[model samples]
Target: MTLPIEPTAAQQAAARVRDAVHSATVGLIEREQLAELIVLAAVAQEHLLILGPPGTAKSAVVRRVASALGGRYFEYLLGRFTEPSELFGPVDLRRLREGVVETDVSGMLPEAEVAFLDEVFLGSTAILNTLLGVLNERRFRRGHTQIECPLRVCVGAANALPDDESLAAFADRFLLHLFVEPVPDHQLEALLEGGWQSERAPLAHRTELSDIDELSRRVPLVDLTHARGLLADAIRKLRGAGLSLSDRRIVKVQRLIAAATVLAGRDTATDADLWPLFYVMPTREAQASAQDVLRDSMSAAANPTLRAAVEHAVLQPVSRAARLVEAARSCLQAGADAPGTATIAEALLREIDANFDAKSLPPELAAERARLIERVATPT
Candidate 1:
């Protein structure tokens, strides 16, 4: 038998990112997509905008992911009356005394490597205008205060997409748009149980900003030769379905594809990385349509690190099996050794049976199903 090969540094780093992602997601319910998206956008060096009603765990997920990565994080809620000073910083009165104007950006959005802004569309024109510079060029400029922003990824959240035509251009700057709904009826029991428990602790994993930078640096080095043709075909299919992306978006999707390659610990990209293109669809309706339109093209899509994302994007059985395996493991470990475990275990068993035919279920999920079934049948 051949000896096992050692993992490359890039692959090791990718694994760290994966662990950080799942660690953040451990106790959260139905928010796996957001946790995974945070890493995807961060690795791509792109921004993400999430549309969901309040009481969904959007802020909690972003905060935990940022903490896992160990960086300067800034979070703010923007409103019509919100001032640029609130996010950027107050101007320097000391500089004004010397007949100069500048903003003290210490501990503000510009210096933050990871940021989350709620109600992002309600910002005043000044805030948006100033923010455009940070998101686009990573540069902040004001009267006399100008510095390069260290932002790796920024997430914006709102109850819904903006209806104002004028705000559309600003919104379009964000490359990834995800619309999230509250936990489903079946998962409500788990959601309630998770929230009611006290003494929740944050993830202990330590992933530095440098690891993220390394992954992003690899994006430019990834060979996209084999994947380009399939990506082109996917674009054509999206247009054929009457769901269109801007020429700019068409070009920048390469960043996401390349980033996915880096996250997958590969130096070359392929059809397996193409699932990212689906998340770029501007609207939920367009995304639903393109899911069918580009299904055949991206049937090979898979990512070990982002199993939940791949499953959510492509809806493939293989990815679904991987995601379910993860959920099963979490349920077994995080659940208290108290009563009512069998109820939760039974729900998980039903989900596994619903998704896969008994004969076709992958061995990993099959084993998980067995364990869950045992847990359900055993008396507490």
Candidate 2:
């Protein structure tokens, strides 16, 4: 008989934190990508940027994840007229009288473990420099003094990418740049039903700071040699396609890939771990090309059968939609007078919708699914 293996301490901790954080933000519709990035960035001790318009639950997602991690949270919305004192804290008047210059550094970004800056690129030049140092070096420095920061990850949200070349450096500080959009039409009802629930109830289970600290320490220890060759090839392809990835960013990304491996309870990083690279493009225009390169890379590295299965599901959605419709109709007919018939039909509709998003199906399939749902929903 084969023996069963137990999970390592690091694996257990990673799973615990992942579950806690995911459960805390479950109310946000179609936010699986955002949640995964949040956990990955936190475990890697790197920053993230969410690019989307206002009211996309960008701030809510970060705030909820931070709350579940039981960390000191700081959030600010920057505007053209914003001042450094608003984000960094005010200077100490008493200290100035004694011939010293110091910001209080209390209850501000400098002291926060998880910080969210909405409209992050709107800060003035002075605040921009200070913010960059805090993000890149994890240290806050002022005239003649510097202090270490406890920031695990800083989440920034912006309506659009910065147009000025001067802000490129600041933009590069966040290793992961995820694009979030409003929920699709099909998910709107779920969004309305559950979105407010997350705001009202706090997460029951909390992940202590020590758990994240331990995970960070173990992330770099995971082996990356297995995927090194594939990663190099992907990097070449990205650069050949007009994307610029700095050496520092490349090194940082290794840590993120290793962190993802650890989260999967593996000691060796695999080609699949490179999926996060899709979001690291330096420019918005480069995202589609980068995605294509990364997807092709992943497909090349994946098993042939698995790749074909994914392609079939995504490319041949008509067959799958027909199957789902048939299933729903059968259930409704069998349980015509049963109380659970409507519930079953609703569940099938949700599955169809989820699969639609997963496969990026055509509008025709979506229309068919809607018609099927309506037929099943109408009383006999």
Candidate 3:
């Protein structure tokens, strides 16, 4: 567990996360947001809850991340009848014979570095109560079966959030919530292509578990003196707009902000890193409304490793502009004469113009706009 020097550690950790996420997303079309957040949660030592329908590839995304990052992966589909032992493992008969109870955690959720639990809310009360300790304290405690869990991130996926009031506390333990939907019709052709590629190709990179551990250790040491005021102001605006913010969430969100800074290759967090505060809200509806409320404080929010995540969090011109520039650049680089290049460049130009005012466009965005315009006007 040798930690690198200050800024160098940030740079190395950022590169590791970026490469792993990039590899995980290679054949998965439009799922980069999920991949990026998976790495973020691992680095921050928190949990993620994904709200998407049955066929949305939630488990696939988590599995890809685990594969690219080279860790032990465990996945299960939970049901009302799923026994605690089904996930935790069976009790040791030898220990039971001695009038002691303990779980044999070999190849179980407690031993997994990365895990996914589908239909998480359907788990019985006994299961959810036990699962909470793993999420909150990173420990497994049941009778005499106490063990430290090495789990980096536990992703819980449900088709929809539960309507039961009693489940709310358990669900809230998953601090970050992401809502996903079926791919829209326009991307169906790309979806077909990506699906075929995914079946044929393996992930492109491998990262060590120590990379994640080093980043987690760095999260607490990140300089937040300047970013704190920005975050506080954003919270005030969200509250004024009628979004509830519990004191616990307000305190814990600092970890997410610091993790973002480290993953963005910076030692000190700035106003740009405050965008993760949007995720502290407990529900999808609250998150959607938060985008508009916190727009001013987050105009500078951008992350090269997490561009897709930034797009999902903030839909402002600057954020939208980043994605447009990436699209335009990719189209330009694939030989401006490549098939469908003009069509892609045309779409990017139109999107750029629609999202940004030419008279007041940010300089970097304005340059990308010019590049797109030139590519559209002349095919080669």
- Highest TM-score scorer: 1
The list of candidate 2 runs beyond 4 A from truth reads 1-3, 300-348, 351-380
Residue-wise C-alpha lDDT for candidate 2, range 1-380, written one tens digit per residue: 99888978887787677667656655666664576677778888898998988899888878777888878999999999999989988888889899999988889889999899999999999999999889888999987558999998999989888878888678888998887778877666657655655566657567787778887888878888978888899899988877878998887888877777777667788875666566666666676677665665665232110122122212334435544554455454545564344444565577676777845756655665666577566886
Model 1 stretches astray by more than 4 angstroms: 330-344, 357-360
Q: Select the stronger candidate by lDDT from 1 and 2.
A: 1
Per-residue lDDT tens digits of candidate 3, residues 315-361? Answer: 76667667667766766775676555565566556556766786767
RMSD to truth, every model: 2.0, 7.0, 4.4
Per-residue CA lDDT of model 1 for 1-380, tens digit only, reads 99999998889989998888877865567788888888999999999999989989899889888988889999999998998999999989998999999999999999999999999999999999999999999999999888999999999999988889878888899999998998877777766665544127557576888889989989999999989988998998888888889999999999999999999989999999999998999888888898899889889998888888888899888888878887788667755474345556766777787778978899999998988887766665
The TM-score that candidate 3 achieves is 0.87
- Measured with C-alpha atoms, the lDDT of residue 267 in candidate 3 is 76
lDDT of each: 0.87, 0.73, 0.83
Ranking by lDDT: 1, 3, 2
Which candidate's lDDT is highest?
Answer: 1
Show where candidate 3 strays beyond 4 Å: 1-7, 327-380
- Report clashes for each candidate as comma-separated counts: 0, 0, 0
Give the TM-scores of the predictions, in the order they appear: 0.95, 0.80, 0.87
Error of 3 at 189 (Å): 1.8
